[model samples]
Target: MTVSALTRPGERDRLIVKLAELDWVFILALCLIAGAGGLMLFSIAGSSWTPWAINHVSRFLICLLMLIGLAMIDVRVWFALAYPIYGVGLLLLVAVELVGDTRLGAQRWLSIGGFSFQPSEIMKLGIVLALARLYHGVSAEKARLSWWLLVPALMIFLPVLLVAHQPDLGTAMLILMTGAAIVVLAGLSWKIIGAAVAAFLAIVPPFVMFVMHDYQRQRVLTFLDPESDPSGSGYHILQSMIALGSGGLLGKGYGLGSQSQLNFLPEKQTDFIFATLAEEFGFVGCVSVLILYAAVIFMALRTAYLSHSHFGRLAAAGTTATFTLYVLINGAMVMGLAPVVGVPMPMLSYGGTVMLTVMIGFGLVQSVRVHRYAEVTSGKGSFV
Candidate 1:
């Protein structure tokens, strides 16, 4: 046999081994979550998804392609584009303030060819990249100083404030949490964290009263006392609680949920999806779903820990934290522990743009995982 032919089978075998080693758990978790979401969405949309379902399915397929494509790219490329992408995100946020569509009182969407997308979604990933890049190159000694580390804090808060000004309290709060988690993981001192906490507590009252809308304030109050407006602001929560409790220990069975099939639960497939799921699947099902999410986050964080590059590590950690916030906040809102925030549950909520963006993030984390063995020492990496 010729040398080329002799080596061909060996190379092919190695390639197959590598492909086989690629993490299937993450992909399976995503599929399960999406599957649950699709089932609920189909029911909520009244079993006929001729047009809208096609759009969602198209988005999922496109995102699946992007996930595979992104997984093959080097994390360095995303690191390179971090700044430019953040710049674009800022421009889009500004555009939203100026010429964007005003929907339901807030101008958070950009209308293009009759389709609108929330720029805040893009901002989440962009800010994560930007902050990850910023925090990647720092020495442990440098990270210990509060004054020296405040720059990345600014990078985090600036966009958060912009999001807040759009009155998207949900997105802004998530952004702040994401950025703060990055900073914490980057090895900032606890002293600095304590100071920030103190400052937040001091300033929250004025911010809530002066900056928050009446509706927003009422939501907070309603959370404090849902009984106060059981027929009004608290109606959603009251119904959600009833639906969840009605499921008892073993759920009412799929398609048999009274709250959902009877149209008693509002936004059953969107912000309050957990309610529907809990009603149909019960506590055991809810716990199992939570375990899947926990596993996904655990794997993502493990990838970050194993990564050999700072940018890849920070990026992975940031992606995991952001996703965790999405799941936690949305679940909390559905359970009535939090005020009804418009944030969608990760992978399990109705929305094409967010689903695609989130999966793209997972793809990036996978990219980071695959390259974790390679020692990438330089901070400068391509964004391709």
Candidate 2:
């Protein structure tokens, strides 16, 4: 064997030391947020772990392990797999169209044996990875041109069209917005961006009327005036707003929110989990969770800024943007400021897949944090 082969174990040992140097503050903040979710889920379940709390805790532990494992792997490994992962994610979405589970009136889940998952969720990370790789090889001059822009435009558009076909507009919008963010971060010109935004605005009303499914159109209408159908199509927004406002300053106390404990709030365990927390713990608790989320984003953006590679920078920043959208969309949805979009509040929501996807993204952020000084180039990563 060559000398490099003989010394591979030493290189592995150095990576382990780097793992020990991972940012604990970020990890601890993550745990606190997850812990807060458990408490709220407990309340949402009428103070029983039988339904939600225990599972939330368990899934968080598993995802935490996954996070650390991914963090230990060299960024080059992620770099090499980026496009393939994106390709696989695309295939999974296509497969969903073929034989996906139809649940809650949306065909977004794919079932395998006993396990079911959402491919759109995977695309959230896949888009970030793929676009990061694309832009890593791009120059600012190329990024500025219209023809060269087709590369990223198609990368962002294709999955978006598929996900929207699933009629999962929530996740579709997420992918679209996050992908655009990566394109912007890739050094797109303001002239191009402005024209694009104008084009989107110009087409939105017609698109909503013609292109949106009936339920999708209804959601927009409901957002504009939830009272229009308070007992029917607007029930979720109405109940969530009631729960949110009733909490007052100090809240009704845990397990005692009338809207939730009485079973008026829809999907409280998942999409409306933030409202569950707010109803039980009031304004103070909501602010606390937001602060935790802000800290995570701040650290992630900081990690991106310190990264030596463009992939690391864009990947971290894109992941951060997706997460920020999760918070904004969910927070607004529950407050009746926007349409109900079924976005979970990171670890705070009781869905296993969403939690797993978020942790996987963080694992990449942690990779950037641990190896921020490490440099990699197009088509190759430095071994040491």
Candidate 3:
């Protein structure tokens, strides 16, 4: 083979160069996190890939492709599709109400062509995009306590209510926080922010007393005192705490975590997966993993800060907030610091839908990076 022939470019070579514009650091960080997930899954499967490991890796690879494809598209396309995507997400939420699948006494899952789908996951992104799109055109001056705020408030609350209706409080809280952050970023005044905070604090008591279901109320009570029950509403937390504490500084080694290996840990592959990691890998492993997540959030926030376009800024920041909240909430739950709300440990937790949504968000973040110069203004006329 001639060197000239090897160096020559065709469509495929050109495409490769184009895709290389992507931020490789962020991509590598994601791969490392996913690799940790696969390893953890393997450990959970008794040092095998037959069950969770291979599936997690395969899903991650598939989602990585989706990420690249999304990155390659014009972010303006994302901006333009924001509201439409939000609308579709809303419809899916409605579909869940009509014919949705139920698991664990919660009507949150949806079935589509033999695939388990969750519309609330989609709304996580859709709401961010919609808020970004909504505030994209409006001047910051008009966003603060104006009648214009009503539309964005509705955009947020509607999905939040729908998700809450699914009884998926974790996801609902995620959506609500994402919307609130975007509005704040859009420059909602501090006075309004303070009042909103006060209002939320004011509502918590009544909401917990009157709004929460029996089990949900039990969870809050258990969070307050897990030792009180030890084996009922508090079983998961107590067991998780024991496993975490037993891991000590260096952990029990892979596939040797007594809690999981001895069948003492609950939800080893899902919500409490972090506890499993802490059990096997110990505090050092957990901290190392957290540093990685911190780096990811830092990069994401930096992307948002640097993007000239308001849409890119809001979407990127909101997505980062979602990821951060997921990690924080799940970590706290496993460590007995917060209520167990079924929030997974991001890539470390096994879930096809959440993985896809996270990767897609990073893909959009990469788009912001690559097309940093490709600015789009706020308004319908700016849509491409």
Each candidate structure's TM-score, on Cα atoms with residue i matched to residue i, is 0.91, 0.95, 0.94
Task: Report how far off residue 126 is in candidate 3 (Å).
Answer: 0.4
Better of 2 and 3 by lDDT: 2
lDDT of 3 by residue, 214-235 (tens): 8888899999999899878889
Superposed Cα deviation of residue 205, candidate 2 (Å): 0.5
Per-residue lDDT of 281-322 in model 1, one digit per residue for the tens? 899989988999999999888889988888889999999998
Q: lDDT of candidate 2 vs native?
A: 0.89
Q: Which 10 consecutive positions of candidate 3 have the poorest summed lDDT?
A: 375-384
lDDT of each: 0.83, 0.89, 0.88
Q: Give the TM-score of candidate 1.
A: 0.91
lDDT, residue 293, model 3: 97
Off by over 4 Å in 2: 1-16, 380-384
Worst 10 residues of 1 by lDDT: 375-384
lDDT of 2 by residue, 232-305 (tens): 99999999988999888888998889888889999988999888888888999899889999999998899899
lDDT of model 1, residue 251:
94
* Clash count, predicted structure 3: 0
* Number of the predicted model whose TM-score against the real structure is largest: 2
Question: For model 2, what is the error of residue 30's alpha carbon versus the real structure, in angstroms, after optimal superposition?
Answer: 0.7
